[model samples]
Target chain A: MSHIPLEEGVPGIRSLVMYRPDTGKPLYELAQVLLRDESPLSPAERELIATYVSHKNTCKFCASSHAAAARYLFDQESGVVDLVLDDYQSAPISDKLKALLTIAGRVQEDARTVSDEDVALARSFGANDRDIHDTVLIAATFCMFNRYVDGLATLTPTEDAAYAQMGERMGTIGYVLPQKPA
Target chain B: MSHIPLESHLPGITGLLEYRQDSAKPIRELTQLLLRGESTLTEAERELIATLVSSRNQCRFCTTAHKSAADILLGESETCEMVINDFESAPVGEKMKSLLAIAAHVQKNGKNVTEGDVIRARNCGATDREIHDTVLIAALFCLYNKYVDGMASFTPTDPAFYKKLGERITTVGYNRLPGGYDQLKTQS
Candidate 1:
């Protein structure tokens, strides 16, 4: 149950966003731009960044749903999503992505703790200014999102299929505002 | 200076926003809606929540910038300092204290905010909207604090800078600044 009365059966942030469309609209727009719109980062990589941060925050709904989306986006390389989630260091991904994820993890734990060495490491991996900036922003944004969903204690559906559908929708269509229940 | 090359004259989030206008657009709109949009919580109250969370996150740029905006909105009372230092002991009303408590918990970790905290806020005469907005405001600043600090963006040392910036926030709002980032360079 959510902290406030929300439309029944709607899950996670969708319910919360429906609860306040004024604030929700901007949030959705931000997500769409960050995850789907034109950027140096591919949609798969961006989704992975969001998933990585949410997993660190222990935000079950965000983690599961985003992980599913990352998997969908990764397609043939889908297995890497769980591998990175479990322990990114050993995950079979590009060194550049690993470096970026390292920075993202640091941002999740404590932004101030993300030292110069971290930025240098990402740059060494051929990450440009945009890459590093987007990675940090993505991580930071998810921190806000993770808290928003859990702070209200929104409903989290239990089944894997639920997340699979969410993952596919996010991977394909990107983020859009959840409409109010009719 | 930021971790990446940015307009040297601009400070904090202004420089970052300039760095990527595409992403910055939505972020700016969200800030406008969360902080300046119509709500039961006054702009001052919302700014207070942002200041408190930024202070806890130890993001000097965000803490100082928002604290100044909150001070101007609060006018003569200027309770932002005390509130940031210790909202629990601050002289704010029960409703505000309760909402700040919720905001504080959200700052530490979302799970830290228990159901009891929400109920207590309700008891303090906080409406659902107030509680909801408080959490969102706190959450939003967490993003801002991290974004500013994560990249090691510039943090102005002069108090005067914050004073003017604060005035700008209250007057100009988040959607559009008076002179925009390019003009911010000359102002300081």
Candidate 2:
């Protein structure tokens, strides 16, 4: 059973959102702008940023779902998302992304730890203001999402393939709230 | 020295938001809902949650601002200070302390929160909604603290300034605060 009386097996933030739609609406809107909508960072890259932070936080549901979205968005290779999460330093992603991920990693642990050198590094790699700003927000925001899901002890499917299926739906429908279990 | 070239010297997240109102509007709206919107948790308690998290994150600007707001709603200054320094010894009831303990754990690490914490809170008379609200408050401030300090925004120096601002907050309210932080310069 969840911390609250949620349904049997709604995973991650999904169940929590159903519990409180008032908070959920803004959280979804934030995600829509941060991950779904377009900007300097491609939607795939944004999802990857979220995926990386969720992975660092060790939230399985978030990491898996976002990796699937990233894989769906970027067709160059299937394993690329996993590869980058494991070792973004060596992964084939652009230097700009690597730099942004470095900052994201800091935000995951301690926001105060992000230094002038980190900002300079991203700039050196050609990440402009908006790119860096969105990356930090995505990483920081996922911390909240990851905690909200895990804090409440929401149920998440363990099978990695389940995330792929959910990811397909998310890719098609975006971050709309699903009906609560009856 | 922000990641973005935000111009305001105004303290805390305001400077960062001043750079981009498009991003700021929804965040502002969310805070309005969470902090000021009608809830089982009084606005004071919500602000207390926010203040406690900021103190843990060591974000001076937010700690000062929200603590003042908490004080205003609570109508007592020493209790607010005691809660921050040591809630166990503070005059607050056990239920509020239990909720604060959960919030503290959340500020430290989300994974640390366990079923036992909820059980303890329930034993102390916290409802499901109260427990849920505490978790959200802790988690949300984790986001806000980063938004404030992650970009190296200014921190106001005078304690009196925060007290005055706190007194005004009840009347003006969070929703009434400027949406476009870029225009903050002119208002200041």
Candidate 3:
């Protein structure tokens, strides 16, 4: 009953990473800049937002992978991820992070939904202008990323262990092309 | 200068979650199940789509997190995430991803973008009724998440470290709560 011809036999990262290199040059460059560039937000916080937003969206791939990464950052603290995933307002975190996540949520729903009060709250938390700017970019970019993955009818690994392993490698290596699927 | 009260933070998963929990929540729950539960689409692909849609919506929280996670799922390969953050045409995958990006673009711009050609392209990618179902789900979530984050005005962390942390987080675990911020204030 599925419309797309999903190559289920491909297996894990190998199957998902099978995009044309030439086709993805620009996107690759942008992602590199966004993830690796010198910005105000920490890598962990940024990724946390991504995971949180994905969870809100209920994107399984995003929620699982980001959750693993978040756990790695906080030393396998599933509670932190759960807090954000379950209810950011109730999550035990800095006011600044809460402010940022709040902004991220707005980006997920509607940019116009972001109000002046939101900016002032972020300011109170010591978030600078650049940090605020980057937040918008991160939110915007995720929207694109989420659609891209889901749109393609791409494969998701069934095993939780697989995501954990992938998280371990990703945590250390960042995003480099793997030779084969682990 | 702000219209809403900066101090008035909405507490605890919004009353919406609680209300839905009491009843058999339909919309959000249905969306969550479709997104996280078993389906024809792969987890990575679905995340990719979610990330892409969030990115387009400028949802820093969702996009950055999912990008890193997507990176891991792809064996730390930045290609797919890259394609998502910027150009969709650049390929490491299929036309379907690109097409869905188009759908996200439509979502970003508004309903005016649902063109005939785009629909045809989605069809070509093997996307069908279910795929359409998922796409709508992905698009709708970004809208909701964006509304929450934007209005609340949450901050985003830096990038270099964000990526580093993302990679480092591969093995730890999931769903944690680090206590520091004050409890949510109820304003009813």
Candidate 4:
């Protein structure tokens, strides 16, 4: 088995956060607000979006961790989650969700890449201005999150169990933690 | 006068787009599609989110170009665009707009971020899915745009007229030759 380098092991932006967890408190707090905050999107849907982008970016750690979070949200079979990650349009979701995910893909590209036709399609599915705004925000944020993690060569736990553990923690306690292990 | 470093002195991302006219065609095309793609977001709003995130990341070139784009869509007299970029909560359009701007700020951070603050902010107007999807998309693309410009070290350029020029270029043709200098010529 090939041993991964120490610098390349941590997942997401944990290293950057860990290095300045004290300083990053504000940032972490903000994240909690965004996810746990009141909105139409459920925790599961949010995680699913993150998972989708992580999968697209091919970030192993984000993919695993977020996937675990999403799986925890759903009480049924994991096939649907898998399908959403693979191809959201064909997944077992409403037209609204399909429209949202389509916007997410555009976010992965350039904003200019998204077109009026795309907006009209979503509108046909009944996506309002708020929904549109949030979609762009999510896509744009993930881009930065992905970079911050990959940029620092953060460690990504490979074990499925590890991510599962994380999922439980996130689901139960939200994003903030009393103590974090380095 | 301090001479600009030859390497760092390229116009800007927009300039490079013009400079490397051929290669940039793809990104320009991609930008157009993204701006007008089938999403819930409007072209102006989408561009605003992108510009805000780029500014937070401190990418001078992207900030310049996207802001220019925002100004064009929103209008030159719009101070709210600046408010959004300066701080998501700096008193802008509406609760929904604030939510989107805040989402962009969070994107500059990382995803391990969820708390009552963002929730409360979104609750003011944003939906749960909106917050979630916003963060996801913003975070994902920040990586991409950054990767491209960072890797190639693309120059950032946006003039008072650049936005209009970009708008024209975006609408008309990205490659009919803008009628300029040899420096505008790309490596290809």
Candidate 5:
């Protein structure tokens, strides 16, 4: 059961969103700009960043949700998302992303830990300032989302079926949820 | 100087926000809405929530800045400090202390906040709206703390800067943060 009496049938951040919609619109709008918009990072890469942060935060709902989205988008090897989450350093990904993930991991634990050397490594791997900026933003934003969902103890579906449906919707339709206020 | 090439010399999000104020409009707008906008929670309470989270995150810049804001809004320069030192023994009402406890759990780990916690807050006369906003404030500060610390932004060491800024925000509100929103409007 959730801390507050949220509407039934909604899960994760959606339940939280439905509970207090005043905050959700802006949060969703920020998500659209960060994840769904045009940027140097692909949607999958962005989702990967979000997943990594969520995983580090130990928010199972957020990790599984974004991982499903990335898996749908990547569409390559099975359990690749799991492999990346287990260890992105050894996961099959670009060096730029690997370096960026290092920074994201530092951000997940404590922002101050990400040092000048981290930025240099990412830069050397050809991640420009924008890439670096977005990676940090994605990581930072997911921490908020993860906490919001878990702090309230929102419903997290156990079945992969829900995640598959959600992943397909997010992958095809993108992050803009209908502002049809609850 | 900042870890990154931010325009302002002051450390923390101020410099980062100044570095690319365009990208900061969403953040600024969000801040204005939550902290300054009308709601069940007072701006003082909201700022306290922000301050507590920053303190837990150990983000030097945000803790200083927001504690100043909460102090100014509450018209007590020492209340925020007392709360930070010990929220339970602080002079705040039981309800606020409970809310702060919930917020602290959010800072450490959200899942740790339990059903019993919510009941305790409600038992203290907090409304659903108040509880709802507290959760948002806690989560929002996590985003903010990370943003400031992730980039190694500059944090002002001077106490006067925060005192003045805090006083100004308590009066003029966040939308009119000097050239911040004004400059962004014209540029965009």
Candidate 6:
């Protein structure tokens, strides 16, 4: 049971968002822009960053659903998503992405700890200002999202299929605010 | 002195928002809605929640900026500091104390907040909206703290700057930067 009364059968942040549409609208808009909009990073790469942060935060709902989304976006390259989640440093991805993930990981643990070297390292690997900015923002935003979902103890459906469908929706349609329950 | 080439003239989150206006739009709107928008929680109480979370995260810029806003909204300079230092004994209402307790739990880890905390807050007269907003505010500040510090954005040392910034946040609300980001750049 959630701490507050939320729409039943709605899962994760959806339930919380439906509970308060005014706040939810901006949150979903931010997610849509951050993940789905044009940037130096692909939609797949952006979703991977969100997944990595949620996984580190130990928010099962965010991690799993985002992981599924990342996988969906990755398509035939889906194995890279799991590889990055398992251990991004050892994963088979570009050095630039690895460097960005290093910075993202630091942001997850302690933002102050992300030193000048971290930024320089990412730059050395071909990451520009926009890339670094997007990576850090994505990581930071998910921290809030993870906390929001878990803080309320929102429902987390316990099945892979549910997450797969969520991934398809997120990957295909992007983030849309859930309507208020009728 | 930021990792990225943010506007040196601006300070803290101001510089970050200027760097990327597109993302900053929703972020600013969210802040305005959460802090200045309608809610059962008073503006003072909401600012206090943000301050406490930033203080816990140890982001000096966020802590001081929000502390100033909270102080002004509360009309008492000491309560914000008192709550940041030790809310358990701070001179606030029981309802605020309980909500702050829940905010504290969310700051450490959202899962740290238990049913007991929510029930206690309700018992202290906190509405579901208040509790919900409190958690969101706390969570939102966590993102802000990380965003400011992760990029190592500027942190003004002068107290006068924060005073003006606080007044701006309270009076004008958070939707737009004073004079807009472009005008700010030209002045500098």
Model 3 Cα lDDT, one tens digit per residue, B1-63: 222333323221232222222211332343344455555666556656666766666656556
For every candidate, how close is chain A to the native chain A in TM-score? Answer: 0.98, 0.95, 0.84, 0.85, 0.95, 0.98
Clashing pairs in 1: none
Can you tell me which runs of candidate 5 are displaced by over 4 Å? A77-79, A179-182, B18-23, B176-188
Scored against the native two-chain complex, candidate 1 gets a DockQ of 0.85
Runs with alpha carbons beyond 4 Å of true place in candidate 4: A1-11, A177-182, B1-62, B65-188
List TM-score per model, in order: 0.98, 0.94, 0.51, 0.51, 0.93, 0.98
Ranking by lDDT: 6, 1, 5, 2, 4, 3
lDDT value, residue A179 of candidate 5:
45
Candidate 5 lDDT by residue in tens digits, B4-70: 5765534567666665554566677777888889887888989988998999899988899898889
- Among residues 3 or more apart in sequence or in different chains, the pairs in candidate 2 whose N, CA or C atoms overlap within 3 Å are none
**CAPRI-style quality class for the chain A–B interface of candidate 2:** medium
Candidate 1's C-alpha runs over 4 A off are: none
lDDT for model 3, on a 0 to 1 scale?
0.55
Q: Between 2 and 3, whose TM-score is larger?
A: 2
lDDT of 6 by residue, B1-188 (tens): 78889877788998888888888989999999999998878899899999999999999999999999998998889999899999999999999999999889888778889999999999999898998999999999999999999999889888998998899899988987556867655644
Better of 2 and 6 by DockQ: 6
Q: State each model's CA lDDT, in order.
A: 0.90, 0.81, 0.55, 0.56, 0.83, 0.91
lDDT score at residue B23, model 3, on the 0-100 scale:
19
For residues B1-188, could you state the per-residue lDDT of candidate 2 as single tens digits? 55567665456676666565666666767788888887777888888888888898888888899899888898888877888898888888888888888998888767778888889899999998898889888888888888777776677788876886677566666553645434446645
Give the least accurate 10-residue stretch of model 5 chain B, judged by summed lDDT.
B179-188
Report the C-alpha lDDT of model 5 over A31-83, residue by residue, as the tens digit.
Answer: 77888887899988999999999998999898888988888998876466888
**lDDT score of residue A91 within candidate 6:** 96
Model 2 agreement with the true structure over A1-182: per-residue lDDT tens digits: 57888756677788888888888887887888788886799888898989998898888878889899888888667678989988999998898899899999998888888888999999998888888788888888888888777777778788978898887876777888767866
